[model samples]
Target: MSAAAVPEWLAAEVAALSGAARAGRLPHALLIHEAPGAGGDWLAHFAAQLALCERAAEAPCGSCTACRRVLAWQHPDLTRVAPLEDSRQIRIEQLRDLAAELALTSHAGGYKVGILTPATR
Candidate 1:
């Protein structure tokens, strides 16, 4: 989604994150808590894009190759964790594997991003 499309309620958050990213002061982890369908997942992806965007000056441009890859869930440096089929919750093994994956070097030699969706489950 474009920066122009950010909901008013989330604009502040996006700006803060963008500023942090630009300043290289982003935290190691972020917890985005929101009600169902409140755009938590969208924000998570935006954060990832902020970290992995090729244009540091205009991160999360939403049009660059890195941003596009992240939107398509095809970026080698991006790892998504969710419950497996037939499971209502993420298994311990999945978390362990995610941890291991995050520990490895980034394929792009940049930030490695891991997104855990449906975290409320």
Candidate 2:
């Protein structure tokens, strides 16, 4: 989703995160928690895309390369870790793989972001 699509209720949060990032006050790590349909996923992606955006606008310009990649889930710098196919859980192996991936620099010359989905099981 584009930055414009971000819900109004989350504007403050988005602004805080993005503003901090632009001003070099943002932390290297972030954690997002929300109930179902609360737009946590959208917020995560927006923050990530904004971080990688080259233009550094107030919000992520959806037409930019980094924005497109993030919206389409094709960004090399953005890695996703989810539960295994058969297991209703995220395994240690998966975390290990994420750790290994995070050890390398981003291919896009931007910050490497890992979007992890914890297992409900």
Candidate 3:
């Protein structure tokens, strides 16, 4: 991916998170709150890729195998949660599923991202 595709602020946050992950000081969960168009989902995806990227250099190197899978939405480690098509609000069951997923270790020994869009309650 090109630099222009990522915003400056997000790039910096990704760098910081990458350092924490490499140093084994990253948190188990991160709660991100933002407006509809604030790019929260994109940011979460970026973090997941960065965590799983084999050649992560303070950022996700999109050319890596892990990065490719992540970009393709086929990474086994990345989990995205959103409201169901038939529902307007996030259900408790969704959060429960996410909790179960995060309870286990990452497949790639990296972070397992749970991106909850417009968190409910």
lDDT of 3 by residue, 7-43 (tens): 7757776667767877867666667676767777777
**Candidate 1 lDDT by residue in tens digits, 39-99:** 8988998999999988888888888999999999999999999989999898889999989
Q: Tell me, what's the RMSD of every candidate?
A: 1.1, 1.9, 2.5
Full candidate order by TM-score, most accurate first: 1, 2, 3
| C-alpha TM-score for every candidate | 0.95, 0.88, 0.77
Q: Clash totals for all models, in order?
A: 0, 0, 0
Report the Cα lDDT for residue 48, model 3.
71
Best prediction by lDDT:
1
Please identify which of the two predictions, 1 or 2, would achieve the higher lDDT against the true structure. 1
Residue pairs clashing in model 1 are: none
> Is 1 or 3 the stronger prediction by TM-score?
1
Model 1: per-residue Cα lDDT at residue 42 = 85
For candidate 1, report its TM-score: 0.95
Candidate 2 C-alpha lDDT tens digits along 1-121:
4556769999899879878987877678777778867888888888777777767755577778888888788988888888878988788898899899988988977688888765244
lDDT of each: 0.89, 0.79, 0.75
